[model samples]
Target chain A: MASGILLIPGPIVISENVQKALGTPSVSHTSPEFVDLFASTLQKTRQLFQAGESAQPLIVAGSGTLGWDMAASNLIEPGAKVLVLSTGFFSDSFAECLQTYGAHVDKLTAPLGGVVPLSDIRKTLGGQKYEMIVITHVDTSTAVLSDVKSISEVVKNVSPDTLITVDGVCSIGCEEFAFDAWGIDYALSASQKAIGCPPGLSISVLSSRAIEVALNRKSQSSFFASFKKWIPIMQNYEQSKAAYFATPAVQLVNALNVSIGEILEQGLEARIAKHHATSDWFKNKLRTEKGLKLVSSNQRVSAHGLTAVYVKKPAEAISALKKKGIIIAGGIHKDIKGEYIRVGHMGESACNDSLCHIQLCYEALSELEL
Target chain B: MASGILLIPGPIVISENVQKALGTPSVSHTSPEFVDLFASTLQKTRQLFQAGESAQPLIVAGSGTLGWDMAASNLIEPGAKVLVLSTGFFSDSFAECLQTYGAHVDKLTAPLGGVVPLSDIRKTLGGQKYEMIVITHVDTSTAVLSDVKSISEVVKNVSPDTLITVDGVCSIGCEEFAFDAWGIDYALSASQKAIGCPPGLSISVLSSRAIEVALNRKSQSSFFASFKKWIPIMQNYEQSKAAYFATPAVQLVNALNVSIGEILEQGLEARIAKHHATSDWFKNKLRTEKGLKLVSSNQRVSAHGLTAVYVKKPAEAISALKKKGIIIAGGIHKDIKGEYIRVGHMGESACNDSLCHIQLCYEALSELEL
Candidate 1:
């Protein structure tokens, strides 16, 4: 096991109980106990997304990228047009994933460290009909937060048929999201990130309409990611029935269940508040005390889970922080790839005031001359 | 953690070391420590597959089903004719997966608990040229092992250009396999089963020829499973360089590394021999002492990892074993779905004699009047 505080966007610091859950002995996926646990986990996933009873949750054995593939394969058939709100590297990748599945992609590039304006999205939607609209809730590459609720509202007004999809890989657990109220058709995240679990399972929640769109698609191009193949299996598991389409990541699912339980037990509203407060403090310290420019442009648009800061020498700063037992990430955004560094303050690290993970990271980073 | 012994085909008993590895602290995928460890794990995977240095191993975050997607998306172009040797349910699923990617699949299904005839395969190859041929090394549904080496030899003789692929989901670690010697182009497996790791990673080793086919394919329809995107990332990782296509399952990979190390430490030949011995003893007891028929046609074709025995009441037998704190699986083969029960005797359970997992399972089944 690699040590030191992991301050990357993800796979972030996992809590002790979640870690213990990950190491659980192997169990039959079909066993009644596992089925019940799985059912609860799926329901917990729905809660994590703040989704209602009509929504369906899918927890598959894959990274967050598989979620992109699922959306591409299930929602967009060949010749379909998709509008991608590109915040940074991850959004660009999602667009690429869609193209791979034969979707005609139109990208609305956000300004560096900023989100695509709602006006621009509405204008684009008015000009052309899109099968889907993708929004990166918080792009890890830039730490830029998109206003998903506003974006969905714009899409709903301009093109009611356009399915609103949120790439919540970075935002889901820590950020405030209301699936029903926000009118999100589909959203996806991973186990790692703010969920505080190992990086294996791709957790997605789909609106009933989105599920219907997936089910009624003309052709399913991919089998493993095909929603048609997975929906019934997920429905079966959620109903505490044994069903198998593909073997699930049982241990990872167990870990996710534990982490989601902890997330809910602490309460989502309080957890989101803690993350926001942590982000505010850390960003304030970086801007005022350290005199550093953040990549998110402004506090209002910045993601609460993480922050990207411009560094004079990112590699040197990273190495220096490593010496202090702090692990941070270098830049990944293509336009400013080598110009900044990122620090994550979410999950147990941000929620638990006693851990002082954010404080430790700030202190270590302050020591860096870069 | 769901307790009791897990005797299912995949997601079998994970060793203590492997479980400990699974709970490892969060690590950056790009960190030197993790990169080096991942590179080492990839090398160990090559050894596990018994492949030459020319072969490449992919350890992606997914279930064994994702392996089929990889093969379908990477190797088979749309409208390409592919031959699927159907041993049981898994083979049929593999065929379905290939067809989902627009492949024209020709399934050569064997009789219940039987292997496809070599002469029939030769005749099929002689009748039409195929782009690929898929063989299920061990169809978990029936516990019937295919003669991969012999089949690969026949493919080489009849249609040298046809890529030979093996589904080693239930066979990899426990069964005797020689990637290079058998002239197999691609072989895919899972972290669970004989690997004795958690059920998350989809592991595959591809020959240079298979890589060429993937890279030179006309158009890639799938993004997550596409080798075009993964190959470069895998190459960079193998060279101990940081390159990201998607976030890896860090903890699962760590556990897989530990498990692979254990497998190598035990020696593949001895491990295979041990599984064979265990399977022979258990199967003989079922047939001779208990007077029960096996789903497998004969001893020669039975898989070493698991056994499927025909029982009067599979559900009753399974419930009875569950009561004794031993978990086994009911048959899944479509034809004899509920007539037989499966007991996995692979990994630590079968290899570690002192555990007597197989003996306990046998005794539990013996106690069942059904």
Candidate 2:
């Protein structure tokens, strides 16, 4: 039934190899073959974040939102101060998640279609003794890309002891991330989006420091996402040993293994550049040729994975594109809920030149007169 | 790599149709087509549980363990007393999850390879007023089955106000369940077990009373598994309206849609009966013909979904069966973990006569000296 070209921000088009892996017949999660695959996939997940051997990667069965919960539950104890750099709906939700775990949250929201300024972050960090600072690398709602590297630098300089976390749900596979080099304590993403797999696995990478902090936490508040429970299991899996806390989503892990292999095969730098190039090409076409306004304020801050443009009639444009067999998403940011349409150019759409998915979307939009 | 007759207690062999569904191409979670499919799948999930219209079914992207987190985080507030009827590892883990969420858990563990008696449950209920009583319908580790109807009746008679919850992760599709008739307040399962789908989706059904209790919680503790956030979204999706809290695993949901349809097509009664027949046949062959002892003390309390049996050396038997192209699980009950093996007989292996998977497993086990 999902016949059309899917262009959603996440749950983007999956590759053929990934789909085949998804259909793999029942394999015991504890089997040697699965263990080897899972081990390799965990290592590859580190590579996706540009992380080193010291960094630990976790692939659990949940959406990207679960990553936020994991970070909140494992890292932030009650009454701990956390600064959230809010770019859009996702960042706000991340703040809400921290608050849910009893973290004292201070949100620094950017203007509509822009990121929170580095100066504002520095000032906020200076004002408080925070346990952690969260930055969304790319907020899907606004298609706004925050500069994680710069923000991490600010956190390191202004509040050296604070843990720097990144919500890379929409950025990890399609954008530049150097987990070790950038001094990021933790970052999380999903299997879909730029990873080109179906949505299920919540992928994340944590520096050794983050893991140590989690290990030494005074109180533990989670079970499924508990670092105490999962850390050893992940370590054992990385060593190709069978260890079970809860049952892993076997097929999704297999699919992720295949997808991450493809990503590594293409190389992350080239893949990220391809997404940027495609984003530039499509955004140029929409702005200059089609006379459209983007939800992202400028190319400097725009995300490479998706384009959120303010259309005259967002719903009508989406319907028209749907009729032409090109599926796109409508606005999700509360302020611009019905004001724009989002077209994802990540995964196969951006990486596979022969697919021409972005061109198809552009042509469909040309027909819509939006 | 998974080539064999997979006989693990859960993550059992999936059917061809379910595998095909799992490999479905990318689809937007918010698309009309996916929404409609999801709506139908939700209804089918209700049917899978034999639940009434007043019940709400939630299919989230996680393992069955997340269901315990959801139930604990949403229904049990801090300091609330909960009685966990522990049959084995899974039930003990469920109690841990409740305790993690700040619930005051009182565990009543049964003997090895046996279920907690209804009389014990009744006495426990009479001793203290509990906010909820947790039961594992079938503990995969021990292959012990708890009579949910009788247990629920006992709870109803002793403590009518207490919520009755069932962890049916290893039981649902292959075992008899009458949600309304059994007066089950909440029941949770995973797709990989009896449902014949790849592992990813955490499926749960909650009665109106359970929903009310969840909604009425004084303080919410979770962000990802929160009932408050998911309730409206589920309601909207069930009505074929697009609503988003967190992204759904589109492919997993599609596979579940098809699997549940097949489960309903065969009829729950027939499907469940087939599992019982298969279990009886296999257990009889193991006990009488093969001269092996089962972990389950008697046939009455043995689970129909899987068989846990004692062997001279479980690891050797598992390896010997593996050499003959059959995959059986090593025991996981903490006490007899090394002495026995577990053979899953659910879904296609149990219900589809054409598969002959159970027979293959029997023949393979017969070859083993253990």
Candidate 3:
């Protein structure tokens, strides 16, 4: 079967090494080798997140949305107030997820192409006490990047007790995020996206404060997403011991270990800089050379992993790109569903010189009637 | 890296074709090809379950335990009474999962290496009103297969309104289960068990009644595991349309499509029979030749996908098998936690004679000092 370039927001182009790792023969989840792999992966995740010794990492078999469930079910008790900083579709979904877990969610939504201002966040935190504040580091829908560092600072100043949770699905590997320095209580990501692996595992790092809140929850509302059941299992595995609460996605985790290894080998800071430079170059080409506009509207608010571009006849442009053996995404933000397209440049697509995904995408767009 | 044969209860030996599919280039989850693949996979899952038109199949990114969460969080409302027929560790875990969702649980537990009596179930149903009854078709820990057909019949006769939920994580593809004819409401399985795929996806078939229960629930208590959000997305995807809630695991789903296609090509009945034959052959060799006893005690109640043999020095036996490039599992049932070892014969390992996994396992066991 002929395969095309994947330029969508996630499940992006994976490195050959990572793909090979994914196809490695299935191993017993409790096998000593697998345990070692799991342990090393956890330790590397801490390094990637720049987390302190007080932080714990969890790798569960699920998509990125499971991360939201983990934070909601574990940290916030039923009826607790949560403040969601919404920039796009994913932020709204995160809010809905909190509500499903019986948390009273208040969303401070930004303009469609903008991030919530630090002033607004400070005012919101000053007015009421929130058990947690959720920030989508980069909302995939609009390719908007929130100011997590600044938001963390505001929350620390106004409400030191409010836990800060970040949806890092679209940004973790590509964007510059310091969990320890930023004082993020919980940051959740997935194996796909900038991680350069297939989608399956929900990866998260938790602060001691977050773990404490989870342990003191009045009652747990989930089973698979429950941190209580998984904490010991993760801790055991990272300690190179076999503990089974549930059978993990063995192959996916194997691929994750490989991909994360590649990321660390490339150096996290260097990887982030590469993503930023590639994204800036691609966005500049689209704006100046093709006379196109972006959903994020400005570089400061734009995500480094993906670029959402406004276009006329998005279906036609997407079809034209597909005919060129490339795949991009249409707008997902509800208010501007059909007016734009999203192209992701992360992981191997951004780092590898030979892929030339950016050039191909630009050529495809330039050739489009729109 | 030298890989050993996986004879554990799950994360079993997968086929080359399935592994190749796992490494297939990443594609947009919303792409037409992926949508068709997702739709066909769901349809094939229904066929695998022998589910009628009134049934809907769901594929979520998680392990088998996530299926338990789906059943509990979707079907049973908080404070509703649930009857769990427990045979081993997995069954007890399922009950714990249900209780985590606030279900009031009453467990009709079997003695170690036994199944709960149908008469006891009838008596229990006659005495109390249960919103749901959960049965582990084949509990992985003990290699005990519950008579799901008979249990479903008893439940139908005693209380027709009570939803019957079967934990088929270890049994679905290898055990003979007729979802529609047996009147099962919800049956949950995983990709890694008997399905000949790497672990990640929670595959479940839900009756229309169960879907209705999910739809009309007073409030959804889960964000990621919520059926209310996922049901429409599933329906849309199966209809060859792109609908987003959470990003589905694209590569794993692709692998699932291939594995399920292989199962369908082999014919579900033939596949189940192959597992049974292979299991019986392996068990006979252990019993007659090696003079080894099994945890299930009798063939009539034993699981076809795996055999749990009581052994002296399980750790040493496991180590011996591992040294011979074979991997088997140790006892997990609390009562016999250190008393036996589990050898799995399922999926491609059972159907493909070229693997020689059963023979290798037998040889490894025979070489071990009794």
Candidate 4:
């Protein structure tokens, strides 16, 4: 608790309970107790995505980058046609990930800080015989929230056989994602960003349709990404044993249980509204300062997560802030690198506690002589 | 320290220092301090691997299971011939892994509880062309240690172009490995096992030749398993700005560093011999018991780790042991399920210190009347 607050997008403010969970002694992944923890985490993870009956969850060993790979490799095999709806850098990376696995990736791009239109997605899908469609729920780099539900609708109407997947790495726990209702076959996420757990493992919620595709795959398309092993393990532990795979990062999983509990107990709708209000409050403070602007428009912007803004003398601004223990992320996207700064209001301590620091950041910015 | 002892193979034991490290608290992975810690761990890991300029240690998120995918997907493309040396459960998993990635896998299998013969491997390689060879260095299930030096020597004589990959999950920290000396293209292990840390991230060492083969492949791998993404990230991080992709499981990384320091300071050779002595002593004690015998041979065994014993009721034996707070792992491999029990003597308690509860276990087994 004495450590400085993490104001950056991810690996953000872990709660005291979450921190304590890390101190819990390690346990074997194959052990019944560990399986219980893993299964419990999965059950809760499904709740976050609002997954349906057939929505099986899988845990992979890496960053959200692994999620991009799972979506591409498991569903979009070589020569498979896929469409990626891009909002910013993350979407571009997801598309690149698809291409890496030999998927014919078609990017439906909008302007640098804008969301892709559903009509654009339909047009892209109409022209291509795509087997999978991927939409970024919220691209972290741009802080833009795409109309993924509408896009999924458009894809389903245009290409009925196409499997809809959402790159919800930054959105799932912080934003709204109804996987089944949105016709999402798979929704992928990581715990570091909004889930308030330290990063290491990647998580995915697979709809029954996605499970079918995995079951029918040409036999274990991936050793690490295989749902076959996880599914049986998950099933076998239905009553008592809860985890599948080797020992999980037990401490992180335990912490995630706490973070998720706190959020739900406080209520998801309240959390979402608080995030939106905080995003506005941060921008309001920034607007009072000279020559600073929010990159994302309110219409298609991320809520319950972040508000990225542009500022001149960026390096100096970033360094000055970090020197004070108020660290912010530097923009790395081609369009905004060195030209913008982002404030992450996503995790445990990201609400009322950060307001004081947000004011200090504004004061710090105004004091700077450009 | 108040927690009960872990007699399981992996997730074995955590020292007070490692526990303090895990409890040290979380930090932003991108922060300068964290980068310093991350880089420090990298340097320490390289020293542990005994890797030279031509080799580098790469880390990935997830368990040891993820290592097989990283090695195979990066090195083998479609129809890449692979020779798999199977000594036990974990070794055989490699063949399944290679075949999943479109490799023509030819497995050289030994008996369920025996080491693979060097001649069998040479004969398999002589009749066909294999681009790579997969060897599990120490399989905990069977407590069998493959003669890696002999296997690599035969591999070199028979097929010079073949890449030898060793799954060093249970051996790297407990036993010994020489990357450049053994001509091993890749060596994979997880933190939970002999390395003595929480289970989540993987520590794998890859050679320049392996990286070259990965780079030369026409089909680029998906993001998670792509060595290209990792090679650059790991190939040089002492000075690179981009040190980590995901928010690392910080506390666990700290725990790993502490465990490594303890292992290095104590000396691996000395520690391994201690493990051997303890296992030998435990087996001697168990042999004196009325109904217990080791499943693995005295000569072809893992000295730096656990000793699995075949029994009439393995689960009952383990369950009874756990009742006395003397835990041991139940056999999970299909061939030996419900027939063998494993007691690990690795990590923090790799000596007689780990045997404090051995007599207690014997007492429980004797009183159970089974």
**Which candidate has the highest lDDT of all?**
1
- Provide the lowest-lDDT 10-residue window in model 2 chain A: A1-10
Please rank every candidate by lDDT, starting with the best: 1, 3, 2, 4
Q: Please report, as a residue range, the 10-residue window in candidate 2 chain B with the lowest summed lDDT.
A: B1-10
Model 1 regions lying over 4 Å from their true place: none
Q: What are the runs in model 3 whose C-alpha is more than 4 Å off?
A: none
Q: Which is superior by DockQ, 3 or 4?
A: 3
Per-candidate alpha-carbon RMSD to the true structure: 0.9, 1.1, 1.2, 2.5
Q: Each model's DockQ?
A: 0.88, 0.80, 0.76, 0.57
Candidate 1: tens digits of C-alpha lDDT, residues A217-283:
8888899999999999999998889899988998898999999999999998998998999999999
User: Which 10 successive residues of model 1 chain B have the least lDDT summed?
Assistant: B361-370
TM-score of 4: 0.94
Task: Say which prediction, candidate 3 or candidate 4, comes out ahead on TM-score.
Answer: 3
CAPRI-wise, candidate 2 is: high
Angstrom error at residue B133, model 3:
0.5
Candidate 2 residue pairs in clash (backbone atoms < 3 Å): none
How close is chain B to the truth by TM-score, in each candidate?
Answer: 0.99, 0.98, 0.98, 0.93
lDDT by residue for model 4 over A128-237, one digit each (tens)? 78898888888888888887778777877899899988888778767777888888898888877877776776878888888888777875567777676666666655
Candidate 1 lDDT, tens digit per residue, B195-314? 989999999999999999999988888999989888888899999898899999999999999999999999999999999999999999999999999898988789999999998998
- At residue A221, candidate 1 shows an lDDT of 84
lDDT of 4 by residue, B108-151 (tens): 77787677777788888899888999999888768888888888
Model 3's DockQ? 0.76
Of the true interface contacts, the fraction found in model 4 is 0.61
Off by over 4 Å in 4: A1-3, A242-244, A288-291, A352-360, B1-3, B244-247, B289-291, B351-370
